[model samples]
Target: MNSLIRKMSMVITESLMSQRTICTNIRFPTFLQVSSPLLAEPMKKKKKMDPQIIKAREERKRKRIEKSIKKLEKNTKQLKPIEEIDWPISLQKQKLLRERTETISQPQQGQDILKAWRSYKYQQSLQETKMIDRISSSQLQALEQLRAISEDLYIKAIQMDDLLLPFTAAGPSSTPPIIGYDVLDGEYIDETPKWK
Candidate 1:
C-alpha cells in the first residue's frame, strides 16, 4: 500500500507539469503575436516628384546624350583619315619639307636672297592665318547658332507679358488676370482672418 501511494503521487506531479508546459507554449505564441506589430520595422514612404519637372529633366538628358553621340560620330570620322597617315614615311617627308622651307627662308649674304626670304616668310604667315581660320570655322558656326537661338528666345520673351507662352490658341497669348480679367472671376476676394 505504501509503494502504491508513492507511485500515485509521482504520476500526479508529472501530469501537472505536462499541463503547465502545454499552457505556457500556447500563451507564449499568443503574446508574441500581440506585440509583433509594435516591435516590427516601419515601412519607408516613396518621394513624390512633379511630372513637369521630371519631363524637363528627361528632355535635357536626352538632348545631352544626342549631343555626345554627335560629337563621338564626328570624332570617329576625323580618326579614319588620320589612321591612313603612315607615320615613318610621313615623318621623313615632313623633315625634308621643313629643311627645304628653312633653307629657302634663311637670310643669305646677298640682298636678293634676303628679299626672297622675306617674301617666303610673308607667304608662310598667310598660310598660317588661313589654317587658323579653318580650325576656328566650326567654332564660329556653333557660336552663330547659339546666338540665333538666344535672339529667338529673347524675341518670344519680349512679345509675351508672361514668361510662359500660351500653348492653346483659345486662351489669350498673354495669360492671367491682367490680359483677360473678368468681373465674375474672384480675383480680389480677401481671405485674411478677421480679429475676434
Candidate 2:
C-alpha cells in the first residue's frame, strides 16, 4: 500500500508540471488556409513606372527651357548700339583742359630755349597787326608768357612763320603764321568773321 501511494504522488506531480508548460489561451491555426478550392478569383495587378515615361518627362523639361532661352535671346537682340542714334549736340562739349592749369612762362631747368621762343613771338607780334586783332598789350604779354606752362606746345606752334596770320592782315601777309582767337566766339562784328 505504501509503494502504491508514492508512485501515484510522482505521477500526479509529473502531470501538473506538464500542464504548467502548456499555453492554454492560444487558438493556433484554427482556420489556416493557403489555396482556396471553393471558388476561383481574378489576379491582382501591380503598377510600374516605365523608362519611356521618365525619359519623356525629362525631354519635355529640357525643351521648355530651350524655348524660354531663345525668347530671351531674341529680346536681347533688339537693343540699339551707341553709334546708331544722333544725340543732341548741346549735350556734347570739347573742353580745353590741356596745360591750362599751369602758368605759361615760368621756366625751370631746361627752359632757356622756351624763353627764347617766347621772346621771338613778342618781337613778331610787335612787328605786325591785323583787322581781327583785338589783343591788348597785357593780352600779348599773357600769351607771351605761355612757355611757362607748355614749352613744347608754344615752341612747335610758332616754329614756322605760321602762328601769325589771324593777327596779321586778315588776307595774305608777306609771311603766313598760325593764328588764335582775338575775340573768343562771336565777338567779331561788321568787319571780322565770327569764331567757329
Candidate 3:
C-alpha cells in the first residue's frame, strides 16, 4: 500500500512540472528567444590613435633621449685624469708625502752650538752609547727607501682597481670563529642570509 501511494505522488509531480513549463512559454515568448549567430569577421579593438597625439608622444621620447645623452657627455668631461685635476688641501698633503718619501736622504753634518756644559755632556754621552737612542744616517736612508717602495705599491694597487691598502693582523681562532655566529633557538644571530 505504501508503494502504491508513492507511485501516485511521483506521477502527479511530473504532470505539474510539465504544465508549469508549457504555461511559462506561452505567457513570456521573449524568454524562449534564441541569440543571433556570430559574425564571420572579428570585431576591431577600440585602440585607434590620433596622428597629433602620436607625434607629441614621439617628440617627448626624443627630448628625453637627448637630455640623457647630454648628461652622459657632461659626466665624461668632468671625469678628467687625476694628474690633470686640481686636488684639495688634504689630497695635496697625501701627494706631498709620497713625493717627500721619494726625495728623502741622510741628514748633513752640522756644528753643535750648545753653551751649557750639562747639555754638551749629555750629547757626548749619547754619541758614546750604541746607536739605539739616535736615528743613524743609514737607518734613515733605509726607512726612506721603504717609504718609496710602499708608495709604489699603493700606486700599483690603485691601477689594478684595488684601492684598499694592505694591512696585517692576528689570525682568527678555530674554536670561536670570527666570521659566523652560533644560532640558538628563539635567539638572534649575527649572520644575514640575504648577503650569502
TM-scores, one per candidate: 0.23, 0.17, 0.21
Kindly indicate the candidate among 2 and 3 with the higher TM-score: 3
Q: After superposition, how far is residue 49 of candidate 3 from its true place, in Å?
A: 1.7
Worst 10 residues of 3 by lDDT: 105-114
Residues 1-196 of candidate 2 have per-residue lDDT tens digits of 9999999979976875655544445554233223434776888776778989999999999999999999988899677657758555554443343326866664563488778899999888866764226556655666578867788877775676755564644665576554883644756557877788
Task: Pick the lDDT winner.
Answer: 1
Question: 1-196 in candidate 1: lDDT tens per residue?
Answer: 9999999979976865555532436434322222223566778888999999999999999999999999998898564556556567777877866665344533455877778899999999999999999889976676677667897755544464753665545655774567775567656878999999
Q: Weakest 10 consecutive residues, lDDT, candidate 2?
A: 28-37
How do the candidates rank by TM-score, highest first?
Answer: 1, 3, 2
lDDT of 3 at 134: 57
For model 1 the local lDDT of residue 19 reads: 51
Worst 10 residues of 1 by lDDT: 28-37
What C-alpha lDDT values do all the predictions have?
Answer: 0.72, 0.69, 0.68
As a TM-score, model 3 comes out at 0.21
**Model 3 clash pairs?**
none
Model 2 misplaced regions, further than 4 Å: 1-47, 79-196
Better of 2 and 3 by lDDT: 2
**lDDT, candidate 3, residue 83?**
64
Of 1 and 3, which scores higher on TM-score?
A: 1
